[model samples]
Target: MNGDWLLRGRDGRLSVYLPSGDAVLCRAELGPGGPWEASPRKVGGDQKLRPGPAVGQGADGYAHLVSWRPTKPGEAGLVHSTHFRPRLAALDWVPIGHPDKSGDRTGAPAVAVDGEGRAHVFVRNKGGGLSMVAQKEKGGWEPWRDLKGSDVQEDLAAVTGESGRVELYAAVPGGLLYWRQGEPGKPPVLEEAVETPVRPGTLRALATSADRTTLFYTDDSGDLCAWRPGGKPVALLASAGPGPVSAVRCELDGHDCTLLAQRSSSGRVAFAAYPTEQEAAGAWWAESGPQLPSDARVSLATDEDGRVVAATLSPSTGQLLLTRRKDEPGLALEAWREG
Candidate 1:
């Protein structure tokens, strides 16, 4: 492996990863003229403010991000165990000020493009709760508006469909959010929340098919659940192991839907995959995966035609051990044998 990654844009240009190494923050340019990754522009304000989550460009093209600026003053006196309580505001991140104000970006961040070629960036307000900012027409940005919420996560999706039928999906602690615009240049008609036991922050991964016919997300139990509305969320599996499972990658393979998961431990890396389909209900899934390594592992992505591409993190050296399934040969085109 050359150890290089390029976000292929509609223009076929490649922007090298900033400062090299693994990127903690990244976004796809999406659409023509291609994707671009640059250093985070300094949002002048409090020195105590910390970067919350990186902005993610929608698979369609809009970028999303959020930073935390405190309003309370002084360093964080609370501990991680108490993070859920009080909902501490160490800093106040005001994205749009009086043009004379100062602060950082705040709350959970989300990004989506409207039918009118505008980028909608959302952030939670510490004061008003769910506050967001929109970048109207690829220009600077719009004033902060109150988006309803007590807290939020960074995972979101958008679609610019026919006749200005633009839709946005956000992962909230309550459940999935749907924002749609039937007209032009206006806020979407917010829908009521759908009830679910799992919280948004507890979500492991979320993905939607190109047609929006299939939408899925993983829970703390490691079971990949999905529903296209009017349908039930069927559980995919019981999870590869216990605790927080991450580095997930999945795709719809020919009649079968596939998922790849990693389990990181002491010094050896391990990986596994799960397969399910509409025709499969009583069919087994855990039986589909192979015995993994001894230490840590993480998935990269999947290829078209339903095959998965994953990189297992080398436990001792942290080398990304890559693997994928093939058609004809031995171990399903995804077996790795260290010689």
Candidate 2:
């Protein structure tokens, strides 16, 4: 899944979750830039899981993960698991079933936690529309609710804004579809669809304000673009490769900035830093770190010190590789280390 895999906990430690074989494995930091765990630990129970699982951290510091398991051709069942603190033990994978009772066909799922500390999962339904289920007050989940749309493509992006309202975005045939919560803890209402050409599987959302988010995606020409609600899409710069881009907001030399990372066409990771919500100012791109498989996905997160940490999977060995931004100025990264 193009969703986030790297997450920094409230205690300053980081956790990287990835699909290994039929299971989800987690390699967590002993501390910030840790000597991580000696080896990865398997999460959930013995149940098999589909690759590209989507992970998100809640306001309460728990890591929530969502993935699907194939039951038959064109049919899969969705399951979810949460990471408990102190022991770092993951709860058993609980099946959430499908939005469509007749058939389980669905796109990759995306998860977001609202301000009230409830986790919400969104996935494309069998009808090419969107369906969502959120954690209930005490426990369990509400029935799946269909947030209708047409020709909704996968790689859905979901983010909870500073105000505790959750926003969701999806790519359709000729444009993008958006959903926004009128208030915290309320269901999101579908906004008028914006007409823009977004490459499928490349949409991502980052909250830039208390009630708003900036959507990022690659255009038809593989150029990076950003769009905010009630505004037109702004082209940022050309990307080195065609895929989803990872973004996180942090301080750079005392200035608030948004750091972006993506896999380059040459199998190397590229980075860029732009003033937060200042896409009109433009961005400069540079390549850094070792070259990985051209198809390897990259994700970014900030440490307790506000430094950016990056993680990707080794295609050949299926191991986790990590690097963090150096203390020096600019977007320099430390040497890659296996977790």
Candidate 3:
């Protein structure tokens, strides 16, 4: 599993997947306040398939979901489904692709919706290679294309670049390799891997603008690092735990800022904001937010109004907590409040 269960839809509604005895796919959605509502119906699958689902919402107000499913008892692959109509009464789960090898487990699929409202699915095949498929404008998916690299170390980080171009990144043997699609309907071209000073762990990325993106990763030394397109790798903070870092681009006090959150080995989570790209280049990391337990993973997304929202999963209490940072004057880091 890629450890992505909670996601924010295009309309700012948050949806989460939970385990249920009666169904394989049980989803819950919550808005700004009040209670959580169950999706119209439960989506079911084979008994052998694990619930490693990844979801993405397109600008057209359609939500696409992909999850690991067994082709048979001993073989595993990915299944694609979509929710388009106002009500989610029935979903069409299609058999998209199968693993390269039998009994091989595939990671959770990564999805990106382009400016044209086309959905792209990137999955790490069981052979440790990366492959992709896209949704056609009219209906159905195109053929699966193997982007070809047998050494991908983790789930891919992808974002829609400026002009509807797609960019994908993975942590490989010596460094990170990136691929950018030439244009719509053109094959993606792979670039040379850029070596890093420290061995990278899982990668997390977000597009700050059509032309700019910020990449974050946990290093072998458990420190948090940041990198941008064609920029030098910089360590943002030391002693960060092995947990994944969540980041997003938003307006902080009416200024563009990139907010980052990471957990520490001491069982506390800290958040910081870099008001400008130049400040982030200087590693000007200021601690923010109340300390949170280290066991949970954080997922961050920005709303239409530029509000930075965070969802954290607490393993000890089995609670999913939602928090948002307060917009205040000055450049100092501020505390986050529960909704």
Candidate 4:
């Protein structure tokens, strides 16, 4: 139930991936307003995985996924799989191994595809720092390399800017750690860290403009905040609940906007929309549909027509629930549909 679970493929069809029991399952949309497949497709074969697999789609329209696979007590590793085309089954999960050969504990992983269609995976390493592996020019993976930082928490955030350069962020004790590529396809360099009180597991990133990304997270008091590089954090909504918020930039009423969905403390899905990067203007949160499990994660993505598609698991039945933004205006949503 990671924030990256829902994605739109190149063909304009939407796909939702979630951990069902011990295996991951995928249900795809037939088309806009079309029904989802009756049966969920099993991804990565019979491999068992930790819940909340991270998924990212490249410019080529392929969906790439990474998840934690528990091995021995200290030998757990991350595995990766890809759907090369829309509505097609994904390849089997391949073990990417741990960053430390000495069997250090690994935290959750985050994946992002660069401008050149290479997928980059980042995770908290053994020493509470960050390590990464990226797809090589010819489709092979480069060895895991350390992208130094310390006291890092789980819930790492990674995003590829409109310029194709990939940037990463992690919550630390007193502030946040940052990294970015000098240019597309280049390795990321550690940038100046921002001093702010970011709640662990609530960090999320969205590219609001070309070459720039805005970070969203709940502050120490559980209030939502937004910040961009070289700028002070801007406080947004209050009581955004716990965990991360799913965000996507799309056009609303002919105006560019950013849509966010989060499971409120009341266990209901709430949504908010505002002009992209205009947080100071203000935003209002509206509860949507039915109540989900307090711990259930929500995801947001845009369909081919730029309509916001939202997904979450049913609290009672554990079924995949999906809804989309109505074409009329604002953040109005269609009825909740089960997959």
Candidate 5:
């Protein structure tokens, strides 16, 4: 269970993957709205599996996965998977281009699918700048292109906007730097980066639209802060631990919900709900749960009914526990499956 993870595929399937020996194993269900019947499969080959994977679904209905693939001991390269259907069969993993010689020193790659159904991958270069490879529409990959930035943090986030426009963000010394790619064929243009009120620890970003990109990070004081591009960063009263954070768009009671989840300092999972699409930091963050253990890794995806379904690893059993809320005001949590 070294490389354990979960994500919601673009087609509304909730998939979970874990590392087994040298391969990354996967399983998925249609949606968490009903009973879950998991179908397990292996995604990678004999390469060692990395824990976290960046997943995105293309317009063509194929889910793309990017993770580190070890070529030799201590040397790994960023690998990309073919257009595998997450709700069905297994993946035949393939290295995007030539493997980077840096080996396991590379960081995890982030992927986003354009509106044109092309996949773009971003990974950390040995020299610290970000390296990217674009998947062509006709069925191939372009040579790796370096998108140079100064002192870029390993983690990069991307989102697709209108017409497949892409917005990429990386944490820098002061704040974050972003780039906008108007079209798949054009080069990316760098934009003005801002200095935050406090130095950020790690970054979490999601783009709902071209104009509505959301960024979150822990301030130097360890309080969670949220910001949009060209907007001021505002701190949330919610305190967060060092775990990962993510947000998704789902429907609740006929309104759009921006659901944010983070691990608390005490190790319990905390969820905050913004009931509207036009979200302002600290506007209205509602919390609920059947709280999870401190070490649990949480994954969120929307069900067919447009409600949020969360899965976390149970500490005692090491099994994946599914949590959800019913149509009522209070959250009704349940254990839908194990492992």
Candidate 6:
């Protein structure tokens, strides 16, 4: 299924997670509606799965993963593949394998699940070292450890009320780290990850506020911060320039959506709309027009309530997009894009 976020959950339910083994537990479920009238439920299939990218879900519903597999797949080639032997997973809908035994080779693996549900995995080890592993209440998974702290760069958050705390935001080109998790084998209280500095700006994506006490993020020269510790991470709207973001969502009602498609830095493809918990008295920062299609970088699209669209991934040239505010528009398109 070669998935990359294809999310949809507000009940109309939709999900896609298949990066094709090496470890990619493609789980699908399209029941209530949407994503084509629904009819997909792979339920969770990972023979031993080993694809590493990034995945998370907490508040205790459980579902965590980090995909990365290129020992051979389209020639991203990794013959020794960082030396193999790093497969950490803790699934939901059902799947959890933790006896701990990884050696990470930096293929991008960043996972999260804390505030007491356990499971907090990180990686950047091809011998370079940044490795980490947690998950100990159910007992098991705590071996590949080695995070001497200095230059770590992980990302995971869902601090919903902080029961055991789930927040692992790391940055270390210059420095920033905060691995706070209140209850999980007694260790996770580092601090120094509250970004915004060093120019070209880059906090990129972070969202949690269905009562997670406000924590919305987005920054990479486009500005959009908003935090919860002593207050000060708010910029909200075109602060620098350059485009092609297309991904930063957290709205089943938690509100906070960001999607951009190339053309700035001087070219011109500016689309704006920001507001993810910052409206108690004057909430007014609206934007939802028509922007995206000038060298689209994955044709920005969103659904589940952030409904917006623009697609064309390969139609002569392709530049996709999709957003249906109930007008019921989908499939049956000859152009305006989708291939």
**Against the true structure, what is each candidate's TM-score?**
0.54, 0.95, 0.82, 0.94, 0.83, 0.28
Query: Which has the higher lDDT value, candidate number 3 or candidate number 5?
Result: 5
* Best prediction by TM-score: 2
Compared to the true structure, candidate 2 yields what TM-score? 0.95
Cα RMSD for candidates in order? 10.2, 1.7, 3.8, 1.8, 3.6, 17.9
lDDT of 5 at 237: 50
> Across residues 139-228, which tens digit of lDDT does each residue of candidate 2 receive?
988899998998888869998888877889989987998999887667788986888888888888998876679999998987899999
Give the backbone clash total of model 4.
0
Candidate 3 wrong stretches, greater than 4 Å: 1-6, 18-31, 38-48, 84-92, 99-103, 197-201, 279-295, 315-317, 330-339
Question: What 10-residue stretch in candidate 2 is worst by lDDT?
Answer: 312-321
Native-vs-model 2 lDDT? Answer: 0.84
lDDT of 4 by residue, 5-80 (tens): 7888887788877777768888888875568888778887888887668888788888888988878775677889
lDDT of 1 by residue, 1-339 (tens): 111122222233222111112112222223222222233212222334343333332344222333343445532210010011111121223343311133333334444445554655544444424444565665666765665644445554444443444455556664665555647666655554554434343233323343333334556455655544445567655444432233323443443443434352333333444443351544232222334455433434443343454444433343334455566432254454320
Candidate 1 weakest lDDT stretch, 10 residues: 77-86
Off by over 4 Å in 5: 1-12, 30-34, 37-39, 50-52, 59-61, 98-104, 197-201, 275-293, 314-317, 329-339
| Stronger candidate by lDDT (4 vs 5) | 4
The residue pairs that clash in candidate 3, if any, are: none
Clashes counted in candidate 6 amount to 34
Q: Which regions in candidate 6 have their CA more than 4 angstroms from the true location?
A: 1-37, 45-131, 134-142, 146-155, 158-167, 170-232, 235-339
TM-score of 6: 0.28
For model 3 the TM-score comes to 0.82
Task: State in Å the error of residue 181, model 1.
Answer: 4.3
List candidate 4 segments past 4 Å from native. 71-73, 102-104, 314-316
